[model samples]
Target: MLNKKKELYVAVAVGLIALGGAAVFASQSSSGDNAAKDKKPPASLTSVTISDQQATHIEVVPVKTYDFVEQNEAVGYIDFNQDATVQVFTPYQGRIRQVFVKAGDDVRKGQALFSVDSPDLVTAESTLISTAGLTKLTTAALERAKKMLETQTAAQKDVDQATADQQTADANFRAARDAVRIFGKSDADIDRLLQTRKVDGELTVNSPLTGKVTARNAAPGLLTQPGNAPAPVTVSDLSTVWMVASVSETDLPRMKMGQSVSVAVMAYPGKIFQGKVNNIGIAIDPATHRVGVRSEIKDPEHLLHPQMLATYRIRVADPVQSAAAPLNALVREGDGTMTAYVTKDGRTFTRRAVQTGLEQEGNRQILSGLQPGEKIAADGAIFLSNMLSLQSR
Candidate 1:
């Protein structure tokens, strides 16, 4: 039985060795297959070429030179030219009897705006009439007195008394006439008043020029005086509108009188009004440190009104030539600086720093740090940034 057990153990060991050998061979075969697979190149990396179909989809823009105008941008508010603003006030205390025009009404020169009731105006008118009547009567008396003195038919004392009476009447009449003239009353107006019974305080206010009424102070039945707290009305000529703007000190050197300017009002967007620089303020504001500029726009149709807010762009001659590039070519860095990619070859790009100037016509001005004819990556700059990030990682 011991011999049989030993033979059985040896047979078991042999079977175990055969199984171990088979397992080792299978492991080596699996490793060799893996090595062969690793030696083969990936399909994406080996001898790859873009297909004609893909090449047709690629787009490229050639670099070309273009004449561009450099412009400066600023924000400002609008104002009426002070010279065109007219403040109307009453010259005498009176009740407004009738208002011929209302606010926002257009008036012509010498047009009667409103009439007023005032005792002072009446008094002046009546006195003027009396003075003229007395002058005529005194002149006849003086003539008769002179005739009597020359003929010696009347007493000399009688003639002298007549002459003295005439002189006194003449002096009083002249004084009254002068008073009427000072009150803006015409001679014909005074004569008409003399024909009627004396009426106190009746006068009319008229517009001094053709303009639009911007403000109204004296309403019907309102009391007004010469030195009232506020002006009775305010009028402005709309034939020519004013665009007032404040320019920064840095840009003031480029501004000059008679330079062409274009203005846009918020009320009328998309419409451009053209004008010329009429005035430039000599003094700069201390608080804002800006200078005032005025442009005159022709408004024959009266579309523009006073006090309307507008933005003005003045075209001044640039002292030096500037470079410009497509807006998409620039990339802003995390540190607040901007960078652009310059194409060295068709496939490679180099990073370049650039300085910017005014943006006009959908292109940004490159003030410095970039030369013309340098091909810049106008598109896919973000892809380049991502590539750089991957390289860093």
Candidate 2:
């Protein structure tokens, strides 16, 4: 929007040209005294009088106070909210066995995205199977030894030795089961593996957060290691996003963190993404004298996309309470002055010169020449000004 400032001024100039207003006043001279006396309209240069019937065609509105805030704009692009964006990689060293999700796919927390064949997990499961067999065999031997001792066949030392071996085997089995659990196995999975004596090495990787997958680097047979990048996949929570722009360093003084911002992008015309200023750059660019301004925008609907050309307006000052006039009530004069037709009654309107601040919400802020409760011509103001100009000329 800031980039269109020049266009806005040109548009206003065109509008004024289209409306040829009355001359400020008629010039009187000795040579044209008779002509002026012969054909003078019943109106002064800054005032006009119309019939009652003509008043109905013109719209009149009262001036009132409106709250207005000053805002500055910066242009930038949309990006993922980095705080919620994450790189997904394998938790252990392995070869990817399956890729369940592709880029741009939505996933839920704990949902599986891929599986990998982890050699470490397979080794742990294999040890668990071996320990289970040794534990069972030792248990049977210890039972036999106890029975023999009771029958006066085995000595106490022999029974004790068998009991010690059984305990050691059981401890080894428990440790092996724990090692497999580290590979993201449940107790139920361990039990099933033990029952079938099957050693499965495939370890599934689940999404750490509920979001959309933005990038996928994992594929079948791809080798992966913990903390390696280009990550297996990139998932990001797009509930919020960043709008970063480099604005003039001079504007930095008025801008600060936590200021409210309204963003517009080319992708979505007329839709505003509301956000707040989250950061202001400390360093300034020596070439451009600009600093980075970042805002966090809420995108609960997820309509925003990364890299979209975005421009945001941030309020730089507190709102000012001032008299506001409807767009139709203010007219641009031929001499480049803004004028409003002030009326004491419906039929008589005085052309009062006005100073305007900013135009917003279909109203032109009345910086001067009008006050609250004053009535002015809100529509067809040009007709009055033109009629007076024609007769004066």
Candidate 3:
């Protein structure tokens, strides 16, 4: 009875174990099927859809006809015309007593700038005084000798000797008077020195031309001498200014005298100044391989100055037919090349390499690789480029 009871219990335990194992295997199989189904790519991500309006957000431009002026670009500098610059130099050795003018001062012609204490001027004055005194003596002696000769109270040789002495004295007086004049002394001052026998050490320095003082090299009490460094003053007339441009030889033929040009300085951006080509060089510089072109600008208000850097654009007289597009149409490729997209149809964009010209009046000129009346991608070019890149990938 006990063995039969144990056998029944074992059978029940085996049956329960078999059922539990079967249920566990079935659950794992169902989980594997679910995982396999989930492994497939999701339906929502299988494709990308973009609306026509969203695609159109990539802005576009149209090629249009415009009148483009051909221009030659060159870097240039502002300079005083050679005819307008004057270098003032000392005429003699002297000590500067006072300087009345500073650099950048506007002065008129013959305006006194400073005074000099000059020993040469004193010597000139003394010589003039001595010569004038001798002149009076010689004149009296000549008159007496002439009278004696007329009255037959003197010999012919005596009258001739007295006349020769008078002439020598007269020549000496004239030479001394001229010497004083050459020393920059006025005639009235020379006469005063002769009458008073007193020397005036003050020598006035005057401007030779009507212009502004551009340089000051001497100070009060400094010695000014000839053959030394230049005088303390430099003057220039700024009413008319010159712009010097170095143009390539290839562009030389396009330039002509009296042609209108434009100039801009970095100091004043977006402000263009107008000028006329006044001169052109016949020869090219061997080192730079460029020709010098000079333009003259009228500055009545004296706004322009010397040595300022400027950019010049010379207008060529050639008739130009140009194609233009909006600024947004420009695309920079990875290799530093520029490209633009032309829409063959309203929906398709074709990339084209374009050569660009000068940008003027907010529009850029298309030199080549584009036709007028074509539609171009004016904005969101980067998005278009990325799309193309993705398509290629």
lDDT of 3: 0.82
lDDT of 1: 0.73
Question: TM-score, each model?
Answer: 0.63, 0.75, 0.63
Error of 2 at 263 (Å): 1.5
| Candidate 3 or 2, higher lDDT | 2
lDDT for each residue of candidate 1 in 204-278, tens digit (9 for 90 to 100): 888887888888887889988886767777778877777877889888999888988777778886777878889
Each model's lDDT comes to: 0.73, 0.90, 0.82
Better of 1 and 3 by TM-score: 3
Residue pairs with clashing backbones, model 1: 118-201, 119-201, 122-201
Model 3 agreement with the true structure over 1-393: per-residue lDDT tens digits: 999999999999999999999999999999999999889653322112234885668766679867778788889899987788877766778999999899989999989887889898888777778888888898888889889989999888887888888888899999999988886777887777877888787888788899999889879899988767676788888888999989999888888899988888898778788889999999999998999999997777787778899998888966477998777788777778788877755467777888988687678889888999888777776677666656654
What's the CA RMSD of model 3 in angstroms?
9.6
Query: Number of clashing pairs, model 3?
Result: 1
RMSD of each: 7.6, 18.3, 9.6
**Where is model 2 more than 4 Å wrong at Cα?**
1-44, 49-60, 131-178, 343-348, 382-384
Better of 1 and 3 by lDDT: 3
1 or 2: which has the higher TM-score? 2
